[model samples]
Target chain A: MPTREINGQSIEFDNEGFMTDRTAWNRDIAAVLAKEEGIETLTDRHFDVIDFMRKEVEEKGTAPSIRRLNKLNVVPTKELYQLFPGGPAKKAAKIAGLKKPEGCI
Target chain B: MKKLLILGAGTAGTIMVNKLAPVLDQSEWQITIVDHHETHYYQPGFLFIPFGIYTKKDVIKPKRDFFPTGVEVIFSGIDIIEPEKNQVKLTDGKVLSYDYLVIATGSQIKPEETEGLVGDGWRKNIFDFYTIDGACALAHFLKYWEGGRMVLNVVEMPIKCPVAPLEFEYLAEWWLTEQGLRDKVEIEFVTPLPGAFTKPKASQLFGDFLDKKNIKLTPEFSTGRVDAANNKIISWDEQDIAYDLLVTVPTNMGDDAIARSGLGDELNFIPTDKETLQSKAHENIFVIGDATDLPSSKAGSVAHFQADILYENLLSAMEGRPLRAQFDGHANCYIESGFGKGILIDFNYDTEPLPGKFPLPGIGPFSLLEETKMNHYGKMMFRWMYWNLLLKGAELPIESQMMMAGKRV
Candidate 1:
């Protein structure tokens, strides 16, 4: 197990650098994790996606996929891609403190 | 006495050996099948392993188990094929001369051909479900994973089981939902083809399915290289798509021995008469399955259909009779669409997969180009057929040639 320290809080990660526990996540931890994922700065739009994911997880017991977010008009497809750069769903989930998705892509 | 040497005892070779062994007299014709490995893998089952629908026990059996008594099996890697001399040289330095040769060594996935594909993130975040090891490794990695963006991309065309990557996408969607993570994972089906599939009509039908499923379809993007460190695949035209997890079908190439023997095309595939299955380079040489560069789909059903034609033609050639049998390149595939449902598609060299009933003209138990629970069961039930009926050369009830009676014009 590997641990990342952000703002005096310790977060545990698996072998692939994904967070082990969802409860250890906070705004400060997300900011630090986002920087590690190649996003140097988190904008308000970024938080909006992250907050949406966290809130979705709390309500639906899982984070919202980009398709769902797009369907609900919470985020546009182009803007979602722009916000996360590479993989919006995975990056947003990781920053919001969730596990990596399993199975063949 | 004549020597009939068959190379690589996989699907095509096994079927050839079984189909011809009893028919051809053992005293006059010595039939020998050569392969490097003893185990025969039910390759179609490989796709289900990563999703936990299948296991190792379901797919593997000994090659000797299915081979008949009269046919001799040789376990050794082929070093070179001397088609000019009608001889084959093994890796062990043994030379076997043959009067006739049937090349059945199939195509293989070449991950090394892609830059950075086998490096850094291979088996970590980048995985291919084409092989046993690759599938098992992916299964292990996926067990504990929560959810993210999963991208399934095909680097090029002419790969074995072309529809498999799409099947994986469909299964993933179902699996994610079962895990209560469907909303957490965004899946993308990426390919170099212009649409969802190779055939035009089938592509349109499948394109609609992708849309309804909300799986993003990215087509016509030629992959240049994988940026594993950054988790993005770069296209030749400078387009890049990022993924938290990347599933790739690397370039498929025919056996290397074909290239060494100077008897193959650019991709090492044996150039054969598309109708007769006879090698264009040598009259005594024939090719079937993924080894031939025919315009047919590289699939088991095509090989099964080709086997019937090859058997009759080869026997005719041996008897000094006109080779009357011809192959129309019939291919049948059942596409698994997840949620315990699938779609069936049957076509040949000239026909695209059209909507209709299969086998029977108007009253088919199985429908074509339409998803049905029966079709999924058909896909599942095929494992038994592959092991007992198909590899054993048992004639299926389906016709060898493509029929247009039931298919819509």
Candidate 2:
């Protein structure tokens, strides 16, 4: 783990920059992190997904996989990719202040 | 007499029965195994079926032949497990109680989980090598078919023998080249993983192999449904991949019995202690092989290694002793790379597959992570060893825990 000054406060994260302390996250931090991850504008839909992912971690102790989200009909995977380009799972997990998803790889 | 009940007569359960049969006091303990099927298929050989190397005869064997004598066998499907009562009810309405239970009910391909996977094109253009019928049907189709755009899509991850899809592409490319159809056919591997595999090093190695062989790689394509009418697979992200022949590994799930008993996750895999092999929900219940939701691969080699730890822990539990043995998720696999050469990989939870010799530290007949003809021969001879020695609990020279002494860092 490594510590970096994020949102004017030092926070712990893995080498990949996913936050280790999920509780330290807020919308201000997410907006800055999202922009760094190439998410130009944070819309209400993006907040919906980010909030849902945080809720999933609060309940399941892990971020929801793209398949899981699609199966639960939380959000269509197409919209997810459109909302967060590149890899949505990795991006959303970072913004939601959740640990990287394990179990698969 | 206290009863020891086992579910599934597959490799994991059979090996446990053999390992314990000679050790348990026959006068004090009565051993019984239950399974729904009479025939046990050598699942690894299923991959060779599509390439015309192996047939149905090579893989099919009577499950009764594998179990040792003095063990009571029940041929019936499991309905549910009443874990609290320490009893399992068979589909035939018979109740069998046990002092201890071992669940080895492995996973299977659930093609129906994906939309249109089992539709009009199934067994004709859409085939999966995970099942006997699918392999044989694909074999028949490949024998006379001309080359066309071929796409192999893996619906999700954590499927049994994670390397099978890679090996399939290797063999298919070689077979196509040998048949002078390499130029006519276009091949693509579509996977949800970021790369060729879960592990970083092996993924790089395998991804390079695919590139050198000219097979296209499509990564991060989360499959949503199959358009059988148009012979295209649609991703949940709205990506469409067209293929003349679609070979897919659909969503794999644990036995439905796990679901009926409410002892499993969403995929019906029992939540297990990764090291102790004990069910998280019960003390007396042990889980082995693909039935467990462990992060380790679902392969015969994984089950074989788990058996070593499980056997020790199981005996300890029987004697009211604390479980001491810990499984490090050791998995050894031989990858057939076609053209009579193969590669081997030995890894555990913390280690990725590295390049070096195997079994023997200084000298090994089988080289790891590098393709060699000797490795291919090792794979060919594994069948005989599997049937005669492995199933009978013979102690192989290879350690249950992976050894890194010979591997290069």
Candidate 3:
């Protein structure tokens, strides 16, 4: 399995750069992943989404989508794009340390 | 011996080799086609998969089964195309050079291009009918899904089979009613296009049918993201179209290899002469089907129509004769309106879909832009026509150019 070094710790990833293990994720790791995803800074809004996805993954065994995020009323769909420039779900899933969701391609 | 290389063994590529096999001097010219997939899918049948109208076996067949005996078929992914060098590199690290190349690799649905579309909700509440996996998943999802708001959304345009969403909507309505769930499910058609279709006259006609079916038309809604948690599609303008089950037609773009080769437009479609179907970038390279940035519907019928003209033009180019045949962007579509009824539309780059009889002008057979049981039969019968005639490059009764004889122009 391919892996990337974040904060001097080796983190495992798949060929597409998605995290292999969900438990290995942390706020510091998300900051590094966010930068890799082209985000210069991790704002509170970004954390809000990350936190929601983490909580959902814990409860439902998957990350929360924009549709699901919309239900929570934390952010709008337009803002999700702003948060993740391209492929928010894949990026969010990566940053959240979840396996890349199926049927994304 | 000179080699003619073709990319993609789908509808256009298969037809190209089948048509050119006998036309070209076999001793002098060798034809080869490359595609990563082993199986050739009858894509039109994908529309019926969710409804159990057609099974996987009904649509898929080995690519080798359709290739003419003399033509070579390569099952490998293309790594890069060096058009300037007249060569292509495969993922296996093999390089093949060709005197002439035809790019028939078509468009693909990219759900990830849209934010939140491919999230946890994908293949769960949100499904696409464009792919075998997506269609099969949707089929399973629809089986036990108690009805609610069902939205069939086309995220962006220039998609293959523009009317497929409408067809799906019609079928969904028919299926729901048959299952006694019609009253429980509210179906809506969401699109980025301002009308029901690109053509004005046809949009008007189809708009009436959608209205009659009581399917809400949310046109001109540029989709921003899919809020799967809330089961809604959000527009750029913050307009929310909620759905319990969303069947989305995500953004359709040309093959990524086109972009990797640096031979594609903004959307990865190869820039080509609309009339000649020849690539504007390279004189030796020709493009056909959805891969070319031609102003024609990216349907199997359009590919079949273009194949006829492309065949003539390729031969002329090789012979050093001035290319005489011109493609008129001719396209024919059979719109399945469900409940054993369908509609047909025939048009070209210049003509809008009109009401009339097809094939023989004034002779009764298939009606254009009119819903009828005969049109439904025509639609169902096309699966046989595709496998036996269209892919084999056997010429049909229809002309390569658009005929205005029977049309109410």
| lDDT top scorer | 2
TM-score of chain A of each: 0.89, 0.91, 0.90
Q: Residue A105 in model 2: shift from native, Å?
A: 5.2
lDDT of 1 by residue, B1-409 (tens): 8999999899999999999999888789999899999999999999999889898888999999989998878999999998778899999788999998999999999998777899999999999998999998898888988888999999866788888988998888888889888999999999977788988898898888888889999987667689999999987556899999898999888999988998876567887898999998789999999999887889999899999999999998888888889999789999999899999999887888998997788887789999999899889999999999999999898888988988887
The alpha-carbon deviation from the true structure for residue B337 of candidate 3, after best TM-score superposition, in angstroms, is 0.6
lDDT of 2 by residue, B248-336 (tens): 99999999999999998778889899999999999999999999989899999999999999999999999999999999989999999
Candidate 1 backbone collisions, by pair: A100-B147, A101-B147, A105-B152
Assess the local accuracy of residue A11 in candidate 1 as a C-alpha lDDT between 0 and 100: 81
Q: Which candidate wins on DockQ?
A: 2
| TM-score of every model versus the real structure | 0.79, 0.96, 0.80
CA error at residue B68 for candidate 2, angstroms: 0.9
Better of 1 and 2 by TM-score: 2
Model 2 misplaced stretches (Cα beyond 4 Å)? A40-61, A64-85, A103-105
Candidate 3 residue spans exceeding 4 A from truth? A1-105
Candidate number with the higher TM-score (1 or 3): 3
Off by over 4 Å in 1: A1-105
> What is candidate 3's CAPRI-style docking category based on DockQ?
incorrect
lDDT of 2 at A7: 65
Q: Could you give the DockQ of candidate 2?
A: 0.49
